[model samples]
Target: MLNSKLLHKKLFLDSGLKTQVKEVNTSNLEWTKNFGDIAPFMQLDLRLIWRNKRTKSSVWMLALGLLYGLFFYPNPTYNNMPFFFIFIGIFSTGIFLINFGQFVPAWDSGYYKLLMSQNIKYEQYLKSKFTLMALSVVILFVLGIPYVYFGWKILLAHFAAAIYNIGINTHVILWGGSFNRKKIDLSQKAAFNYQGTGAVQWLIGIPLLVLPMIIFALFNWLLSFEIACLVLTVMGVVGIVFHQKLMRFITGKYLESKYKMIDAFNQDN
Candidate 1:
């Protein structure tokens, strides 16, 4: 009788162990599948951006932003002015964000419904957009390194702006994306493409760009330029530190608006 009891206990433990192993393997497989989905989506986005004229203009815009340093570098007064960095910060980091982000799911309006029918998660879609924009920020910063000739402070400001952009503005733009309902024609020339313009796109700039500039301006005016830069950098650092929480919140917002976005994207306009 004791042997029978021991045999039963061993079988039960073996069964539990097998179940645990199966669960872990299932989870790992799902994770890998999700990872695979993201890579293809990201690659598709890159290819589309390269092939589409309007989206491709983002590269030129970034180039223009890098040249902004040329305008201020020669003038000692302008070079030293703190407000100058604020302007550069906005343009440099915001180039791709403003151009591409304002369109959001609308950019895929032509095939948005088809995409929705797929097995993709809203989190994955939003993450792809965020990841692409974050990457552009890095590339733009690298291109803007020539501005370091003006002063290390210029480089410092650019770094601060890049941090704030990736950490804060990226999520803000995605959150704003929840409100995008207009359709954009990627084939159109970027020069005057207003296909997807909306109030939310316009209003987003205030928080993403203006608020930081305001903070910097006020501090630079009242305290010192150095203090203002530090303040902006600190704000950016805080945002970077809390990025995961912000993404989670943004993902919730996307989920809440998922149906609405799909409906909006289907419209003829």
Candidate 2:
């Protein structure tokens, strides 16, 4: 009887071990599958950022944007000026989104047609850009946290601006890129390189940078500084809430301009 009991226990232990190994194998497989799905897109973005001198310049610009507060925060003359703070907040937080996003698939101008020929969906392509821009806002905002040493108000302003950038400005720039899309020569020097600059880049700045300030200014003028910040943050939250819808709309814009952009980019080659 004791021998029989020991045999039964051994069988149960073996079965449990097999189940555990199978579960671990399944988990690892899922992880590998997910990484496989995203690896190409991740590699594409990294290559665009590091291989292109002009696109890489945006990293330096991001560093500059982060230190921008050191110039204004230390000056007493700029103190108590909430509107100026709002401007700095938006510029510092969204600088990358503005610089990088305005170009969009234009950065891929060299191989854009080939890229389009791939099995990748247009919505996926645009969403990747959106994700990159949104990630920049979050990262910039986190890095900007040290500015709280200057004043809590400055931090609040930056928080609102970061939210606004992530939610509204990201979509705005992506949509803008769908219009007047231009080709960028990755071979161009990063210094003073405006290879892809067009009217769209200039015009889009109004909504991305200026419009937020105007909205904040009105609220600041009408009520108080805190109220202005609250209003701006609310606007951003609303934008984030409808992110999927906004992405769908922007993807459609890119689809509509697909042929036109192809023609324009071809002209550059």
| Cα lDDT listed for each candidate | 0.79, 0.85
Write one digit per residue (lDDT tens) for candidate 2, span 93-132: 9888887888887888888878888868887777777777
What is the C-alpha lDDT profile of model 1 across 1-269, one tens digit per residue? 99999987777777889999997765342432355667666766776777888788876777777676777677887855777787687678668876778778777887887888896787778878887888788888888887787778778878878877887788888889888888878899988767788898889989888887888889989998778878877877887788878888988887788788788877867
lDDT of 1: 0.79
TM-score of each: 0.81, 0.85
Q: Residue 42, candidate 1: how far off, in angstroms?
A: 0.7
* Candidate with the greatest TM-score versus the true structure: 2
Count residue pairs with overlapping backbones in model 1: 0
